[model samples]
Target: MSSTIDESAYVEASNGQACLAFKDEKQEARFELGVSMMVYKWDALSIAVENGWGGPESAEKRDWVTAVIVDLFKSEKIVDVTLIEETLLYAMADEFDTNVEDDSALPIAAGIVEIYKQCDAQDFSTVEKLYLEWTEKQKNKEGKRIVQVEEDPLNPDASESEEEEEDVEFEIEDSMAVDEMTENNTEPVVDEDGFELVQKKGRRRNN
Candidate 1:
């Protein structure tokens, strides 16, 4: 990928940072669109957005992330792979409380660089391809499907016991278990998981 920028906009400063500007505004917009497409293709972000890991506004958060990267490209003279990776990691931690320890951001950054080079050359083929694929995937929801975790099938009784535990825990939180225990004048019993130990219904405890 060509790392060259507009020579007219490049200026040496005491801080040694160049103020790079796009050769053409239309090309810059196209490059930004490509960046957005590549951001959507990132699997780590896809999982987070699909699972609502960033809260109810997960989709909006994803868009914000895209905007931030595009802005970084615009403002900085040199946007390298490391810088892009750092931006993605920081965004995930800040927006979704997710720490992406894996170095999956590298390829995404590389792809962005390639897109930048292509867009600079006035070749919109890559961006057009990404947009069409993205549109089709959106229509089918193909790559965004999440598989729900299911419990072990053989242990029917175990599943029931777990459900009972969950129900008890839910009820305790919903009805203020601690306050009720104090009012009833009963000792609070807790389990290994720090949850209040309530007896499972329809099951007898060993005395």
Candidate 2:
């Protein structure tokens, strides 16, 4: 299999994070944290690649790449620890464009650790600058989205529509509650043969 993963498979965002996909299907390796975390992951992966990782038919190179990813997660203060193993596996698969086989994942994890060590020692000022620029772009994009929503002529009655929907929902909920209560209070007829008798509608009580 070719080790030259397609750059188009990843979608870069202004938030400094990138969402990786395989053959148009979004992968689970997307970083869900802040820009700093995004920087960390990208930089680590870039460094690993620069050092000749992820080559074809090279077990050592593949293992090194995996290690770089694992170490990156460990050094960072991840929001969810439970997702560590899962994230690591997915990230490796995303990078290599392969199915996440456990046997192949260990070396990749080690490579991730090595990359982190290098990053810590080397100056990452460039990465920081890139992160700042990315965030600014994100802010601008968000601002435009807000302005668009505000200026939308078709959505002039959106608030009113939302309010009407809420009112309808409230009335439906109240009606359901009342119906349940009525059903609970309803008297059931019993037969009498030592059993209770059925109460027919429109019948005289003494009949």
Candidate 3:
């Protein structure tokens, strides 16, 4: 569902917070903090799930979730950090499938606040480390998938030949790469004003 911030939404500078009035797809008026909008919790959760957060170890899951939270906040265009701790508390509870009462949310909120404080202090190692770890995990997962595909039973015999063909195709495509070529390095060529030019060896040369 789509939600748009109302024109009347205003920010409170003292607390670095904004109370946004939003109308959802159903045209129902609801309020959320600017941090919630910045986090885009729904989208972040989907991305985390797709990246195998649910299958990782508890510590790994927590790290990935926190990284995503921080990344969301960093990616947003909003100036102030608002409702970040609250949003993260809710997101973590949802990720862990736990019931987080208002009282229980305090600790989670405190942790997020600490991270935010660290960020404001210009020390971003916490977020950076977690993001790099998560990225490595994704790369490893992709590598494993590729290996599995190459080892598939039905294609076992053809795998080697298929790989060779792929290598050849890759080489040909690489040779055709034009991004590094300058106009002066290539021969002068002209396009037909009203006629199609014959393509030979995947190259258009003047007839």
Q: For this target, which candidate reaches the highest TM-score against the unseen true structure?
A: 1
Tens digits of per-residue lDDT, candidate 3, 1-207, equal: 113322232222134423221123111110112122223223333343334434443323443444444444444433232354455555556665544444433333333444444444445454445435544544554321111122345554666777565444111111111111232285423233221111112211122
Q: Local distance difference test, per candidate?
A: 0.63, 0.33, 0.35
Best by lDDT: 1
Candidate 1 Cα RMSD after full superposition onto the native fold (Å): 19.2
lDDT for position 139 in model 3: 55
Over 4 Å off, model 3: 1-56, 79-82, 114-207
Q: Against the true structure, what is each candidate's TM-score?
A: 0.62, 0.21, 0.28
| Cα lDDT of model 1 by residue, 1-207, tens digit | 334422222122125545333557566666766787878788888777767777765665776777777767658876776777788888888887899987777677777777777776788788778867866665664333444545546766676768555344111111122334576697755434332332112211122
Between candidates 1 and 2, name the one with more favorable lDDT.
1
TM-score of 2: 0.21
Candidate 1 local distance difference test against the native = 0.63
Any runs in candidate 2 off by more than 4 Å, and if so which? 1-118, 143-207
Q: Candidate 1: where are CA atoms >4 Å away?
A: 1-18, 21-23, 142-207
Q: Weakest 10 consecutive residues, lDDT, candidate 2? A: 169-178
Per residue, candidate 2 scores C-alpha lDDT tens digits across 1-207 of: 124322222122224333211121111111111222332334343333333234432223333333343344434442122233355556445544445443433332333222233344443343334446654554553221111113345555567766455345111111111122356696433223121121212211121
